[model samples]
Target: MRRAIAAAMSRSKREIPHYYLEHSIDISKAQDWLQAHNAERTPEQRLLLGALLVRAAALTLKQTPELNGYYTDGRFDPSSSVHIGMAINIRGGGLVVPALLDADQASLEQLMERLKDLTGRARHGGLRSSEMSAATVTLTSLGDRGVDSVLGVIFPPQVAILGFGTPVLRPWITDTGSVEARPVLRVTLAADHRVSDGHLGARFLRELTRKLQSPESL
Candidate 1:
């Protein structure tokens, strides 16, 4: 632990102590909306995206509260905050995730603002130690590296990790019955065998996709 922290230098090494959960999401419309969302992105998108993911994870995790918190000394500790650890790729090939502050309860807008601020700080090497240690769940977005879908290892103590894939252009049949290009993302989910079954994992993926397809893109 000390070595890892030293490697971080001023940076904080998140010490998570529980098993993990992993989720991969495929969004067919992600590419299209990301382009538009980028054009009009306000730090607001940060909260909106975080809220969407929190809500998505909550929907599934709430189904089994036993998996919602830390599992230490061979036991689970339930958590009230749906704090989400968001993974970010900054310079130097170091992947860091600053927990979205109180994400489970934050309003959409609030989540976005905090996400933007935390991410900015992380990039500049300004993240505080507390910020790194607070996450209850980790969400990873690989920028453009996620092409389709990726199954990620669950970060420890969180019980889950969500990965995002790069959007790809695929052929889709339009309403006019003509083949057209469509943006689609592949999704994957990994769950702790002790806490999640294939059925639960599938259900989570279904809900995530529904959110992405909702009026507000997840």
Candidate 2:
């Protein structure tokens, strides 16, 4: 497993011209919405913040299609569907990203259920080949470990990886010019320079933030 990871990283570093863009997303509204929404559900059926982030990214990719595809054979191949790789760590060791096929078409409730199932199966080594291979883009997060930010390497064949950090309380100004502490999530995008640029990356992040702010639509 280590050798395979090392080889993939080596190829990623050698072949992909990587560029990174980071954004601080205000997730206060999303958090409030999640809490209220979860309060009405059973504990096992509740939504996770990570799942919400994945949904947001998936929806954003629908509009910014360039960031949701592969770079191979000296060309960029755009996928018609959005298959997001949700990175999950194994119980004892290692990690895997099982693809959530057509995530953009799923409702928030459906997405949460699928994400829970995928992570559970991933830790138990129950993922199928299609789940492992169909990822058009990847989403990674270190929120549980409290990492501030992550600058991920672009996984080969795929052109981009979106990373999320721990959501922290930060001072924010409201529309009425009032200051308050809000939950801010730091998001980073690492993409193949051959397929995208900083402008597109920033736009994707902005769209993602907009989606998160309106959790009801997710």
- Among these predicted structures, which one has the highest lDDT? 2
Model 1: per-residue Cα lDDT over 61-144, one tens digit each: 555554456645656676776667777878766678787756656655666567678878988989988788887766766545
Worst 10 residues of 2 by lDDT: 86-95
Clashing pairs in 2: none
State the TM-score for model 1: 0.70
Give one digit per residue, the lDDT tens place, for model 2 in 1-218: 77888899899999999999999988999999999989988998899887788888988998888888888889999999999998788886777878999998998779988988898889877899999999999999999999989999888999999999999999999889999999999999999889989999998998888899998888
| TM-score per candidate | 0.70, 0.97
> How far is 189's C-alpha from truth in model 2 (Å)?
0.4
What is the lDDT of every predicted structure here? 0.60, 0.90
Alpha-carbon runs more than 4 Å astray in model 2:
none
